[model samples]
Target: MANRTAMIDVGGGFRAIYGAGVMDRMMEDHVHVDHCYGVSAGSANMVSYISGQHGRSHTFYTQYAFRKEYASFDSYIKNHNYANLDYVYGTLSNHDGENPVDYEAFEKNPTGFTVVACNADDGSTKYFDKSDVSYDNFDIMKASSAVPVACEPYVIDGVPYYDGGIADPIPVQKAIDDGYDRIVVILTRPKDTVREQKKDIGPATILKRTHPEAAEKLMNRYQTYNDEVALAKEYEKDGRVLILAPESMYGLNTLSKSFEGLERMYRAGYAAAAAIPAFLGS
Candidate 1:
């Protein structure tokens, strides 16, 4: 059977709600993320203030650190005007503060697994317990055969966006030894870093130039593949299952192409979340 991949696009609205308390407090006078605005928002009447301000004004500047300048929720419904603050953080951090959340502890918990870690330039990383999962390592040969068995090896190296090197090969091998059938070796890509460089376009010449960072990413991907291919070959003869090239499975298009490729490989299976709406009630 083929493995179905699920690509859930949690809209930005969802994101805002998830971090609403944090944001509301940041708008208060002298609000600062570093200074623990999170706790202050909880203690303050942020929800009340926002609810009261609904349909009232375009820009509602409340006490220190709290500014609801967005157009949607106006408590008193007034004119539509946009006002940009000099620097949002300067106002928030300099205001009243609180204790910062223990992100490390949060990450260590099982719930933290769902909290994604998106790198600065938009490249992201996901966590997996090698004990339960064997990923694709971007090796074409190993992945080619493993598709029939629903195995995938992959790695996301932050090449140009980062250092373009594998994190630690020991952990990967340990997972395999612990019974994982495949492995994914993530390496950062040059395209990501180049994309970051192009965040603010100033000169056409600079934009036209080939990004050396992207090249480094490609090179690293190739090198990583070479290393993993040898490892996969050694394991395959030992009877462990494998399939699905890393790039084909988790490449630029991610779930889209990977699902199709895996489907083609098995010719008898459904996607991971064929029963998604059953759970989401969407």
Candidate 2:
């Protein structure tokens, strides 16, 4: 029914009755929906900020924006006949297709806060643990029931950086020079260290933590975001780059700052929500 709901009523009904039976004597064809709408992984942090941020004004405004953007997709499916043929969304199931790895919380949290969450597959999670899993081999643990991934990768050949994090200053400047009017960089630390005293475990266990190759690869992926941020700020482009650091051990706050110190992250998120579209556009 779900699959049939996507086709035109006539087409679907025909398929339900004569099409399948007649084709059964000969051959059958399979069709699949390839498009969908949902909260982008890029915007998850922004959504969390809207929910947890301080100040009712900021929260309400950000929440409204979120609802508007997300709801637009729903409206799109309703008005467009072809939309149902595409994969419309019901949930943010980004991590649905990965093996459940453990989240190890043994890392040092200098700021006593954790703002980012890391999963094994796509370095999408905030932090990676050397002792737990390496970026390359981590795909082995993807969940069995993962939804058929439909989104294509965003690729740029000439640019040196791959994967997400704050764009480094030089590249950022180049992007701006090429006509990116305003740029906002959202930053997050790895999860597992939500607070000073509370250590969160990763999704996987460590069978071998001392592997040098795995450790180096994991460290590079984890450290590059900060390195890019520092490099970006060095370019001196007024406010060309707005850095959104959250108030959690998972973010940029150092241990001395205290988890409470990370409160600014929420505000940063709210500010970014208001600024991202305009910032990215102009």
Question: Top model by lDDT, which number?
Answer: 2
What is the C-alpha lDDT profile of model 1 across 1-282, one tens digit per residue?
322111111111111121232223223322221111011111111222222222111121212213343212231133221111112211221223122122233223231011111121323322222122112111111111111001112223432122111111112343354434332212111111211323123322332244333233323433443454455446445533222121122222110123233223212111211222232221
lDDT of 2 by residue, 1-282 (tens): 121101000011001111112112111122111110001222222212222212322222223223422224453456322111112111221123121112222122111111122222343423212232232222111110011111112212221111222112113433344443344343343212122211211201120132232223234533444454565565325655544333343222211221222334333334334433333333
lDDT of 1: 0.22
Cα misplacement distance, residue 97 of candidate 1 (Å): 31
lDDT of each: 0.22, 0.25
User: In TM-score terms, which candidate is top?
Assistant: 2
Q: What is candidate 1's TM-score against the reference? A: 0.23
